[model samples]
Target: MPYLLPPPRAAQPQRLLAPTVTHLARLLLTHAPAIPPLLTAILPSSPSLLTPLLSHLLLSHSPPLPALSLFRRLLELPHFPVPESALPVLLRLLARSRRYAHHSFQLLESLPSTHPHLLSVPALSVIISTALCASAPGASFAAAVSCFESAAAVWARAGRSFGAAELNALLRVFCARGRVAEARALFHRYCDAYPPDTRTFNTLLLGFKEAGHAQALDLFYHDAVLRGFVPDAVSYCVRMDAYCKKGKFLDALQLLDEMRKRENCKPTLQVFTTLIYGAGIVRDAARARRLFDEMEQSGVTPDRGAHNALMGAYVRARDLQSGMALMSEMEQKSFGLDDVTYNTMLCEFQRAGDLEGIWKIYTKMTGSGFMPRTRTTMLLMKVFCENGRPDLGLELWDYLIGKGCVPHRHALDVLVTGLCCRDVVGEAYRCFRELVEMGMAPTERAFRVLEGFLKKKREFGKIDEIRQMMKAIQLEEHQAEEEAA
Candidate 1:
């Protein structure tokens, strides 16, 4: 009562101004969840305001999950009847956040099929098509395929015909999923029905590459020419990938030149990476390096994949210095190294029998939050054994196991083999026991190595245990053979 007598003016009730769509979009960007009520009130009266707000929400660094709930509520408003218009934006948003894709699919399934908005919005056709292409991990490929089928069926039932853009989206989804036959059939069915565009041919070309049907690609290219569709950048990229796979590097290079001359198509970073990788595989490190430099000079930034391809070229040539130098250059340039790059370098170090170098790299990899994978662990274990550091190998085994980075049976076999080679029979048997406990089936080579060590030491109990494990393994193999028969 005493405090109320002296209440400040700040304590007085203040009127809340209803937020405009623009203001709400800004709030969404700022990640303000408190503005949903204001948003809900304005959405029905001004549906136009919702698009930017929804787009902003979707594009936000940390998007609001509650926006999905708000979107559902907004759909209930009579003025916001065009659900299809919202679909493409929603799909783009879903693609950005995997969690959104999971929730959005559920929301989509809940919507009534008879809703008038389903038929009214043409943009939805594009959304469904894009969603099919950019499917997330939680959403199964089958689910995406089902969604596409449902959308196509819905459009047909509604007597609605899609435009080139929407058809392009559907075609892309089909092509991406490797449904080349289905995509081709749809292309022929819809070719005369709509004006053939660059996108139509691009989809067909991508489908051909995805399916590895090089013959089909030639047919489609010829068909595109007859249909008066000009090949674009995407078309050239698809063809380059196919040509590279077929080891037709000269043909691939020729196509690049033709694309530059006729279509004025500049090869993208991905195109260059594909050629470089293919060249590396064929041990043409010189051409691979040439392409790498050309890619850089052309103002294309080399990504990790490109860098890895160059490293592979160096590795294949057995030029470890050059390979290591490339790794140093990657670090200097602040080009992030992935697990593959680190693993490759580690393998090279192990092969060189440079234990100190391997240990330094191992420390750096672990410190940088790059957990050593099965192959990395096995390589390090082998290095330790060769360097007369069986104790270090045991330490590594324990560390990897503690970190939940348990190796496969093959890796365990390699470690046990390393231990046995060092004549650390007791340590080797201990590791074998741990491997078995970890559910790794010690291979016959691993068992024989451990048994030989135990036999030399006259450890009869350990020998009998090893024999029991061998019998169990043989029994399982026999049972598997019987099942197969």
Candidate 2:
């Protein structure tokens, strides 16, 4: 206390030098992670320095660092209560990150439930709209419905304040998850509250198409026209799908012609695929082929799905040569062949008892980097069994099991039937026991196969096994009845 030095000279006020906004903006653009610490240091001493720093950070920098921490700090900064200008930046970040935007959403939830500031921010409205569509709290329909309700409430509060893009995103998410009722409700709400746009009507029409609600389709068409929402290519596609579903092929063709004449909207690959499927259903492969040719002529590259559909049409027509030809073309074009393609060809060759053709396709599939799926392996095994090659069937079976392919009940049934046909009652009984252990019931056909095998071989031991399987079946039925009661 006695060692007092000369009185410290009163601190002189240095000339204040304000940092240029452009300099701050440049720093944010060039270096994002360093700005947060620099801003935090200056923000406490000179509160007014926050606006420019935050504005620059939010606008110029993407995925602002420590977003959650920064938002919490902003809430505590008495001098810089909620930067209203930064809300848009926050919303944009949320939209980009999607499910990863959890931290930002948590900050939003921290605000007062009825915060008036959030009501005024259009960006906040957009974020809420997206969250409703994208976020699934639990993997259940009820949970999804709850999310939709929450989103609807936010949209209601925003009134006519949201934009067309936000509405379209919401409607798409709803339709994708089969929430058609909610989609319709939101669509109606948008139309009643906001300016009607062609995109808005298109979104609603698509929802009806996805839901398979034929009645709502005509109403949407009329309402869209009355609202001066011109139909586009996508609009025509939706109508086409609807007409096809209702078996109104003539109406669908008329709509297609009208679209071509009025809107110059050319058919897409998807449009042709739909037509092919419809033709296949009605057993009109000729029309399907015409459309396929038209699709090729129009410069649209056929995809694997298109090729598969064509192959399916040929198979339905019993034209194996044509189907094989299309598969060859698919291979030349480097379109990836999936299990379905291989399985289809395998089943066809098996039916024709063309083992050489089957092996050729199998080798080709493996050579082209296509791994055989469980169904493919099962189909091949069945072919082996049917052609009296149990040794080959057993080899395929071991390979599938080793690769962790859990054979389905149908596959087991086929194996059992094949064994019984060869008078191998012991093996058939063993297979039936294994299937029962795996919680699959033997079908009546399996029982008949066992009985026929025992009769042919005069084997009472196999008959005893069959009786045991029947008792097990009866026990399971009784348990199910008790549960129902």
Candidate 3:
């Protein structure tokens, strides 16, 4: 027939992959009914034009509306080279929705030709900050490296001409995640182009501590100031924290003194509290008290943090009398006791087999409506288990789950471990199942504990069940890792 005959060569048009503009417009109307009229006016409803009309409109539209992200996807669907002009708007949209940001980044990199203009500075800043901050939950320190690598690829491809703000944003992400070596290398390489600011230096100082290289922090700080980046109060506080983390309390105190002597560099509460924490670790309650007094003298009233630190010090020194006295003083100041206060007291009492003290503290904590954190709950679990009160420990576990408090894997492991040791297989298996349902795979220790009990009982069927459950967890985790990567 005439239709069966091949279409005339002159009338033949190329096959199109991208949905037609009419189809895309219908989608916009269906999915995004509240799309701006301005956008509607711009997007022509032409069927022949296969590329989405919204892709072109993205360049001109600057609204923060959610509809813009759909255009980013439409533009990338047919592997179209996105206009350099639209990068900023797309990035701002991407910042609000990380899923789109990730897809756009992936698509942009996949396109054969690289456009330097497409990697705008503001976009890169938002990309670096959001990517790192939205990093996978429970990601270890190594994940920080992968996150920086991803951002760095974007920077490198964009001709690496990012502005100071973008570089600072990337540096902050690096420092936040303990990638000190990477942050320092990046700083040294790019600092000359966009000279590091005081905030940049402060972030790097914190990074050294987080990276367990506090020994290098002092030298880095001295070199930074000598390079004409004057230290601010926050800078001093960061350095003080580094020294405190390194167990150099005297050095921290000396740094505090130096900061105080400097014009307009008064140590903040965090600075004093960091030193107090150091003093607590060294059992130097006297020094913690001195720092506390100095904090008040500096016109920064001691907050609950300051009280917490000193009280922690007393507990460390086994001077419960002094710690209790401080608690009384804290009450007078209307500074309510926190979980750490109760946890520290409970742990010590647990060690001493003081059941009465533990009971009193538990009663008070529950009575005051203080929602205990995972640590508080874990400490309580351990205490109850060690004191031959497995029933209470199991009840507490159930109570936390009933309260919608998803325990950490390690915390669940603690319960499993305790129960398994007591040959309480049924209860331990219940906790294991609960953790599985909560999407948390138990620790190897937890598994080993359960396996030991199951094997001793020669219950190969349950053993097989444990293996199957573990396989499911491993498969799910592997899928998640693939998705994250």
Number of the top TM-score candidate: 3
| Residue 224 displacement in candidate 3 (angstroms) | 3.1
Candidate 3 per-residue lDDT, tens place, 1-485, comes to 22221221222243334454433433443344255443333443331232334332232121222345444443544444455545554555445433344554564464324455565545555556555556665563344445545656666665565456666777776787787887888788777877666778887888887887866877887887787878887887777777776777788788877987999777888888888998988789888888788877788888888898888888888887787788779878898998778888888777776776777777677667455676788788877776666656776666555433446667667777777777888888888877665445678888888888989888788888877889997886677457646
lDDT string for model 2 (1-485, tens) is 33111222333453333554434343333343343465555556655544555444343223434343454565566555455555555555455443334444445545544343553334554454445545565443344444444544665654524556656666666775556777777777665555556666777787787788878888879886896777877787788877777777667778767866875678888777776766665667787788788887987777888888788778777788988998989878988788778888888787787787787786676456343765687777677677676545554444433222334556666777777667666777776665554334667777778777887888788788777877886796676546534
TM value for model 1: 0.51
Q: Which ten residues in a row have the lowest lDDT in candidate 3?
A: 1-10
Question: Candidate 1, which segments miss by more than 4 Å at Cα?
Answer: 1-216, 224-234, 245-247, 261-266, 279-290, 346-369, 375-395, 436-485
**Which model is ahead, 1 or 2, in terms of lDDT?**
1
- Cα error, residue 406 of model 2, in Å, equals 6.2
TM-score of 3: 0.61
Error of 3 at 201 (Å): 1.8
Error of 2 at 358 (Å): 4.9
Off by over 4 Å in 2: 1-141, 148-182, 189-207, 210-215, 343-360, 372-485
lDDT values for all models: 0.67, 0.63, 0.66
Worst 10 residues of 1 by lDDT: 1-10
Higher-lDDT candidate of 2 and 3: 3
Quantify how close model 1 is to the true structure by its C-alpha RMSD in Å: 17.2
